[model samples]
Target: MLRELASILGLFRQPPQDASGGDRTLVAQLVGLLVEVRAAARSNKDFTTADRIRDRLSQLGIVLEDRPNGTDWSWD
Candidate 1:
């Protein structure tokens, strides 16, 4: 299922000709924020906060799933 979704998104994942360092930095920052929030929720054992974070990401077109190993996230 995820492979199919990735294939679909691949059609839209064109490389930017003039990408800058800032783009990578911004992406790193957002990922860091997500990790921090996830850690906090886990530390507090607050599933509600974790669910809210997942739902918010969903609203932004990202899907977050809690798997047996850990949490997985993807964007569409």
Candidate 2:
């Protein structure tokens, strides 16, 4: 999953790790930011940006599931 995350976001100089050896907090925060941006783009009727975010995430094995209330995600 970290490999997949790296593929999607190569922003980290090195991926941060925690005691458990996976930085779940950082991952969630970063991905949550993307999700928020995507949602904002959708709300603004910017389908292109929203679709691009979704497609990129999908390519990285992340599945963004849209719901009436909000969006949910999981590793594919």
Candidate 3:
């Protein structure tokens, strides 16, 4: 979750002053789609698939912590 948020924020901040809002919208949409896919994988019992998503996010400096309630994430 945070990985994509960071990605979106990073994208939005890429421009010195005014960023292209279109890129931010696209980033948000993509992030939501990926998160839904990851959630579906977890719901389907494909832990390996879910872990792959988590690992990929981690590689991007985003940390994910799973709890009984849900998953929480942060970026370095």
Best by lDDT: 2
Measured by TM-score, the strongest candidate is 2
> Each model's TM-score?
0.53, 0.71, 0.54
Clashes of 1: 0
- Candidate 2 residue 30 Cα shift, in angstroms, is 0.8
Candidates' C-alpha lDDT: 0.58, 0.74, 0.63
- lDDT tens digits, residue span 28-59, model 3: 56545656677789999998888888777666
Q: Which stretches of candidate 2 lie over 4 Å from their true place?
A: 1-22
Which lDDT value does model 3 have at 45?
Answer: 99
Candidate 3 residue spans exceeding 4 A from truth: 1-33
Q: Write the per-residue lDDT of candidate 2 for residues 29-64, one digit (tens) a residue.
A: 777888998999999999999998898877755689
For candidate 1, which ten residues in a row score worst on lDDT? 10-19
Candidate ranking under TM-score, highest first, comes to 2, 3, 1
